[model samples]
Target: MSSLKHSHLYSYHAANSRLASFAGYDMPLWYKGISNEHMAVRTAAGLFDVSHMGRFSIKGRDANSFIDHMIPTNLVKVADGGAAYSVLCDDNAGIMDDILVYRFSSDDFIIVVNAANIDKDYGWFKQHLDGYQATMIDETQSIALLALQGPKAKAIIQSLTAEDVGNIKRFTHRRVALSGVDALISRTGYTGEDGFEIFVPDCHVSRPLQAEKVWSQILSDFATWGVLPCGLGARDTLRLEAGLCLYGQDIDGSTNPFEANLAWLVHMDKGDFVGRKALMELKDHETRKRIGISMEVGGIPRHGCEVLVKSEYVGRVTSGSFSPLLRKGIAMGYVAERYTGEGTAVEVSIRGKEWPATVKNPPFYDPKLYGWKRVA
Candidate 1:
């Protein structure tokens, strides 16, 4: 069997002219193309096959305590059924990976990590768990994941399942039934929109599901929803607009939460955790800061491009894109503290050309996306 093949949703995406290739699995690039698909989630609704995302379930007597010590967020604050964004950090406080930790019970938790970081993350967990009594299992291959996003997302998903999804608060999850399939429906998404991530077992094949079947059925069911299949391009633009960080781009081993503008996810109040001392030291000592920038001049900025203050090189662009809503090139990067305010004049070097830019607060679009309000 070829290692690279289309996802279960492959034929559905192909019918819509979606570009596809191996992405952990054969995945769609765009169905109606990038522009149209991006606009759909911005204005109405869109569905995504996020089955490629990796999930690990940790369970044992020491699971909760063990995981809390591994990440930089205050896991104690995560209520049962709620999720918290966290960073797995090294001893020096450098990020290993950014992930979502779901506290399902005192002894059970599910961690969702990036697809590319799955093996590495699991390895770290295995090594660290040896001293503790917790058992960590890689459940990535067994679950199908889908994200339904946009202002209409709730309404469309509610019609398919009778799980009282309306009562589920943001970052919280509930067990629901979708077209007779039981699922773990989470009110979470990467698009920065009001959305749900449905985790169904791959074996819900008209019988008790074994988790693996839940993942496959999601990709196989796109035809029933009339959803415009989305690809990585749309995923990037959507997250950028929402001011969410992309791991490899916005954050990495060398990037700290403070420099990535993700310090909110780091809880200094939480008693000693991994990288706590370093993160605390960074907080007390003033240094560089991360900020969002919007180009006044008409042009697209790209990763690794230079951000200049006058004639001096201050920093480099981490992520940039043409804002469909703002109608301008927008970017995020690290700049000196003095140049970190909105309206501060800056320049971005793009392909040997300097483009006029300004420091602005993210997200580039209306902040309403975070509020889940319908765009007018």
Candidate 2:
């Protein structure tokens, strides 16, 4: 068997986590427990090692227009030091992968993409670079990324830096030194919480001990705040509770942004893009809509569970789980447009039994008490 790739912090994960293989990497499913890690992030803080995700730096004279041509989000609207969540699509408007575009300048940008699609996404961008005076560098192997998420995340990060992390604002980043290590710090995260993602170069020779030093230092200092190293299991449930989509499950080449409840990312008036024409034709004509579902007492909704209305087929669950914060079975799925309205009754077929459910808009928790909107 072929060996899986390891992150800079792999040794730490292996020492403390319940290990499993995901996306051809040996990953930690949970440390301590999924529920505890989930709750810690919701109430306190949780640090996640996300170096496996792909980070590509595309920079040169035509970087702006070069990137704007590929995705739906308006690159013009995103200023330097800002990030926009968007998707890469093919000519037919099928999503290649959901990504984050970080514009450092008109001719410089870094894109964070799904780990499993690193090679595919890199090729997608490189093929379009023939005419543009730009270059794309795959930096995934040379960097270590850490996400410190929670209401307490800012405070912990602030103590390590001389700069005011609170002033960084959401969706923006800046060059900062944390624990004496230089890195690009962004106020973004997958968990629906006020957090920061740190990207530092850990090239073994120059920054050999930096990533682990910052990680170990924080857990040591903030142990009383319940800050723990979280694994992928907690990450998944936290994202689902916050109503975020998982690439292969909630979306694929067959799913368009509109049907996936991501129409806001598309900018039709921003001139042309890769999938604009086809997306325009499919706009408002999509037969199904992505919806959130809350299950009854009987079962927990899971991926591929068929959704029904009046015992007839409608859609299928894309992602689901028993929420640790909400204490209920929550899910996100696609359903027929007619049956996608809030409060619409439906059934989720799990193990041959139809469990009662109600259609609702995400997230499955109250925004005022949880997520990035929670009191900070």
Candidate 3:
């Protein structure tokens, strides 16, 4: 068997989790079952060990200019301490990866990417560094990330730090001393909740010990507050309910921003970027579009299930799950552009049976009721 990399919190997960392999890492798939963990985050708060994601630190006099030239978003316009979601694409306009760019200053920034695309994304950045004077350093191994999410996330996190975490707005971040250890806290998450992603330095000589301390401290402090330690199983379900796209599934090298309903990330008016020219030319000619399908029948939709319109196959599901909050099957997939309108009727072929569905704007759960929109 191939050896798997372990995160700083591996020991904690091993003692209480059902371990599984994910992106070369030994990760926890679930602890108290997916449904229980899912509900915890929906109603209370949950902590996620997301250290498997890649973190890169970019610094140089030309960092801002270099980033603007690399991704499809206008990173230069993002204020300091703000983050922007963007797509990295090849010259042919195919998405390389969907990433979050955090701007600390004009010459300093951080790029967070999917774990599986780390090496490829780093190489892509280096290959385009001919004239740019930016320094890129992979910090994935040096950082341990924790995500505290859900309706009660703010209160749980606020109790641990004296940095006024409640004041941090979405897409913004700050560097503060968390539990006497320096950490980067960002108001961002994948679970569609009011949450914070904490970045703790874990590569020092003390190594995982420091990370474990922080993890244990959080659990001890928030256990009575209904904060459960979540695993990837719950994470997937929550993101699916929020209609968030997963890399390698909902999007891949064969898909572009326009086709994935992410055209908002592409800034054509901001000047030339890697795939700007090709994207601009083909933006209007896209035939398929990403849409949400909510099952109206009793069947559960799964990835690779056939999507049909008018009894004819149109596309396939990329991600799907039964939402714990909504108690219904929700899925996201690419379909013929004509069938992408909200309320359009469609069918999903599951287990050789056709189940009626509707094309609705995703977020099977209402944001105001469960997400960041609910303040306090």
* Highest-scoring model, lDDT: 2
> Of the pair 1 and 2, which is ahead by lDDT?
2
Clashes of 2: 0
Worst 10 residues of 3 by lDDT: 201-210
Off by over 4 Å in 1: 5-25, 202-227, 369-376
- Per-residue lDDT tens digits of candidate 2, residues 1-376? 7498777788888898998888877888898999999999998899998888999999999999999998998887789999989999888898899999988999989999998999999999988888988999999878888899988999999999999887888999998889999888999999999999988865542344788888898899999999988999999999998889999999889999999999999999999888899999999999998899998777888999999998999999999899988788889999999998899999999989999999978878888898989865
Residue 74 alpha-carbon offset, candidate 2, angstroms: 0.4
Predicted candidate 1, C-alpha RMSD: 3.4
lDDT per residue as tens, model 1, 1-376: 6566444444455566556554456677776677767877776767787767778999989988899989877787788899888889887888889998888897999999987788989998887887788898887766667787877678776776766678888999987777677778888998878888878755321332433333334335543444565787788888887777888888889888887778788887777778888888888454667788889887799999999988689888899998766677888887877888889999999999999999988767766443275443
lDDT score, candidate 1, position 319: 92
Question: Against the true structure, candidate 2 has what lDDT?
Answer: 0.90
Give the winner by TM-score.
2
Runs off by more than 4 Å, candidate 3: 202-206
Judged by lDDT against the true structure, how good is candidate 3?
0.88
Pairwise TM-score winner, candidates 2 and 3: 2
If scored against the real structure, what TM-score would every candidate get?
A: 0.90, 0.98, 0.97
